[model samples]
Target: MVQFSFFVLPLCFLFNSRKIDNENIKTLQNDSFMRYINLESLYLEDNKLTTIHPGTFSGLGNVHWLGLMGNRLQTLDGGGICHDAPSIRWLSLGNNKISTIEPHAFDCLSQLSDLNISLNPLQSMDEDVFEGLDRIKSLYVYTIYYTDFSTAMFDNTTNLDHVYFSKFRYCNFALHVRHCEPNSDGISSLEHLLARGVLRVCVWVIAVLTCTGNTCVMIGRSLMKHENKVHSLFIKNLCASDLVMGVYLIIIGTKDVVYRGIYNRHALEWKESFGCQFTGFLAMLSSEVSVLLLTYMSVERFLCVVFPYRDRRPNVRQAAVVLIAIWLTGFFLAFSPLIGHGLGYFDSFYGNNGVCFPLHLHQPYLRGWEYSAFIFLGVNFTSLLIILSAYTGMFISIQRTRRSIASSFTTYVGQATNGWIPDIQRKNLRTTALSGSMYAWIVIFILPINSAINPILYSLTTRTF
Candidate 1:
């Protein structure tokens, strides 16, 4: 159903003109341009061309530029390209329903310098999909697909120097590509993830202090003779949990350094990597175990102060069992996402962010929201309540342990369980929700401080009086 007035076609072709566009061109028949030998450019934009049969462009001589944008082109197959036009350098096939590009579709157009394949529904592409385009230099890609594109998609395009991708994540695979546009995603840049110099320094400082403080506490506990061995054991385990937090921070800081400058290039790969998953697991394990350990200690202190006459404290063997159980529980909770991922419960739960921290504050209802909600609202909220009650009861009796209670309360509250409530999970619920500010503050100061403050809060080597 191709319609075009042949009245002025020969006159325009005689003058070596460039436009056959803005017409109701539904299709092109074989040897459509056989007589137009002088035509150097052809623009068939905004047409209803559904398909092009073999030999449609067979005799297009000297045509170097072809613009087929804003068409109903579904597939790029045989006979669409000029049969003998080796001079065709610029080809614009954008804004079409192009989901497939048949083999050798562009084999004849070896001199094509720029290819605009943007705004198409091509969900995935094979590694060697652009096999014949040896001289392709610039590729424009902007798709609605979320698939992980293969890194070797442009390996055969050896001359390709300029790549324009809509998503920053795709920049990683375009190796040897000289120029890639839109490299920054606001929070992450080539220089750093935090985007601010102060936060970058703070991450390293927190990591060092957290590890140093916990290590000192552990060393002092082992060397000094504490009157209560069970108390010493509890303190040792708490320090170990905090040490894990420090390790998590150290890993995060290292990753930021390793990926600085070219952050977007490796952003997606790093986020979906095993290292990120493990780091996030470490964060969860450390944070939860630390909270639980503090709760246990608070209750132990509460029993000693309020019911001082009663022998409610568990023996060393029972305490050992409790520590083992607490660790196992933390491990299970942290590792649950990995297991649930296999069962289709999550997709890269731990690898959701650049820092590998699964805060989900940006979009709380995003993928795996239920699992995160359970961890934050169900487990963490309950632990906070237990710790608060234990400290409150103990403070009423002795009034001396108020200092320890306040520090522990502040530490647990800093985890930000208030943001996890399902009722207000939406960021718009309050008009301003914590995004990177909460993540930055927690990672730099609050989260690491859990282990950093243990040595100060509960001095195991010293008398508990």
Candidate 2:
């Protein structure tokens, strides 16, 4: 038994010595040192190396820390740290000449918790450079000179907590911090204060202009004793939609004010209040419904001119049905996100406002569901095509109608016994065509502009103007 024990101990020591000797031999060759050594820590400082080979740390599975400071590396090659170095927890690449980091440069260091890349000459970092680094806890980015931090820069990281941007020398540097905790109170306070002032002015402006313009249009049509009830109904629907949109604008203004106040107070319950949810739902629903209604109105105008005698003109009943459909569709689309995802309570980074925005579909990217890419692309493309097609078709149809009217009036005048018939008919046709065309143009252009501008103006006004 004694002899056996003594022999086993000697064998164990011999094995350890052999491992050390192998590592010692690997350190002679720079590449082999990374490949063969069971190194727990590596220091590659003060190297004259200007570029690192791809997969430089491909086989360093046991490496727990790596320091590549004081190197002349100008760029990190693609997949420079390719191996699954799960044990690596700390990385220091400070004092390097790295000017650019390729996307996915640090793809394999999932276990990394601390990273220091300070004192580097890095001028820029790609948006997806740190795409898969969800586990990173502390980051030190001290000397990056030229990089704009937009929403796209931190598109992937959701778990990042502490980030240090020390010694920044550039002016007007913008750093967008994404996926941080919701600062509901801070955002709510600012929004509420702004909203109170803006809502008063918006309510007054929208009420006066919309009411006056719509009332004049309605009265003018009535005074003419318009025979076509469909045209009158179309006018009414347009006015009604505009009025509803304006009311929603007021609601949105108030919501912004309330959200800011609640967020500043750090009232989580208030932030998630039913009033907030209802307001969000109503705003989204109205905005979407307005778009659909505007589209419907455009189509109605096109049909009235293109096929006037088709006996298919929409009456008040039909218009109501169409409006209801629009509302239902909008409600379903906007509220669907709420049922599947969480409430649309998101902190706005634009002005540090805490109001309910749309649910961030990109939140699940780190969890393996890449929904944001497809949704963003699909929605924008579809909307663009729809809007473009509608506008093109409307313009083409209007031009054809105008030319036909000009030719018809010219021919009618030559055969008319009364000179007044040609003049009267021409004037009437021109007025009708101009009115319809102008209305369509307003729907296409003015509505979007109004939606965009109302939010800002509503936030600044102090009284209901």
Candidate 3:
């Protein structure tokens, strides 16, 4: 693999030739130079030649290599080349003005092994451009500069060894080679150098907010001393979930920054591997449980307000049972990938970042009927609708209850001493209602924000008006 990285530079030929004038070079049009003397290698680099005719080298049957670097040619007709040099093995056309390559241009060159066309302004390379060269082991093509290479682009090549990109200099160029295997260290080092400081700040902010917010919610619930033990229990569980999520965010963010920076100096430890798997499982579990808990909270509120005495609320014990059920369901769902697919460590050219999240919904090894894209869309949409509908009903009921209370207070104002109703338990009712309202709003607000963050990052990085 390492040896192939050095073969990007083409061999040079230094020889004396007749001093050809501009008119002669210009007059050499298409199909005019078919009978040149036997040439093993030809060098026409760093020249002003703008065209190569169909039969320019038709008779050069002995030609083994060709160089056309640093030229003004805009296109290369593969049909033109294949007609002449069927035995050509190596070809270099780097640093040219070529923007396109016609398919079947090199169809006749079955034994061709190396091809370099880097540093060109090509917008696309047709897949069919590589149709017949099964023996070709290396390919060097110009890619969208500064973008990370994705493995998907090179999936078709079964035995490809190396790829090179050309970098221009004052009067020359050099090739930068990349192997096909994932280079986890290089990816980790680059990510650490670029994202460490920002990630640290993000982790700090998340940790402080999560810890403070959850602690406040817990304290508020405890202070209320509500009679409804089920409501209090659910509130405690939600706080715990939020606390776990916050800790997860901090740990993941810190690891991403630290490991990337020290990638080359250290091998990943066993504890780190365990942490990766643990964090992934917990993050997935907590996220799912949070969603289910929100749904349950909405249903509970709907029953408390809309049905009142008609719908008997779950007791403290029953609520505890439900919470346990939710956790178990989340655990099984989140860790299913590990149980079914055999979780193992993976390192790619991008570096040792973390444990893999279950393969994105398309791996053949995954059991059961695959969830299609449409199903995911429908499931999320339905969940959102259910939560929204329940909350809307709860809000309307609260408004009506407040109106009724106001009317009653007005009617009893004259009969009450000092305008106070001693028998009415106003404080307890207000506390219960207010707590439920606050919890509902928090769930509604956080769900949308969490879902939007990933999409926002992708858009900001890849899209521009």
The candidate scoring highest on lDDT is 1
lDDT of 1 by residue, 1-465 (tens): 655534335544475656766687886766667777877888889888888777666667688888889898888764567455656888888898888776667777778889888888875566666677788898888753535466767778888888888655466667567777545433455446666677678778878877888788889889998787887888889889989988988888888888777676677678877888889899989878877776777677668667778956788899999999999999998988877664545666887666666656554654686777677667776776786787666556665645574445444433323323332343224244455555566556655655665666555323543
For candidate 2, the lDDT comes to 0.46
Backbone clash pairs for candidate 1 read: 190-261
For model 1 the TM-score comes to 0.70
Supply candidate 1's per-residue lDDT for 51.
83
Per-prediction TM-score, please? 0.70, 0.41, 0.48
Give the alpha carbon lDDT tens digit for every residue of 1-465 in model 3.
011111232332333121222222321344333344355665656666566666665655666677767767788777556777777778878777787777656667776788878787865555456666656777776442422233334444445566554211100111122252123211122224223354355555655666566666667667766665676677667666666666666665566556665432332341235566576566556556666665676677566666767846688889999999988877776665445433232221111133222212212122222321112233333444566677567667765645443233222211211111211122223223222222222222232223223222212321210
What lDDT does model 1 reach? 0.71
Kindly list the per-residue Cα lDDT of model 2 for residues 66-130, writing each as its tens digit: 77677667787444554545567788888878888777777767787788887877777877777
Which segments of candidate 1 are over 4 A away from where they belong? 1-11, 14-36, 46-48, 82-86, 144-146, 185-199, 217-238, 255-277, 288-319, 336-354, 357-465
The lDDT per prediction is: 0.71, 0.46, 0.48
Q: On a 0 to 100 scale, what is the lDDT of residue 22 in model 1?
A: 65
Assess the local accuracy of residue 42 in candidate 1 as a C-alpha lDDT between 0 and 100: 81
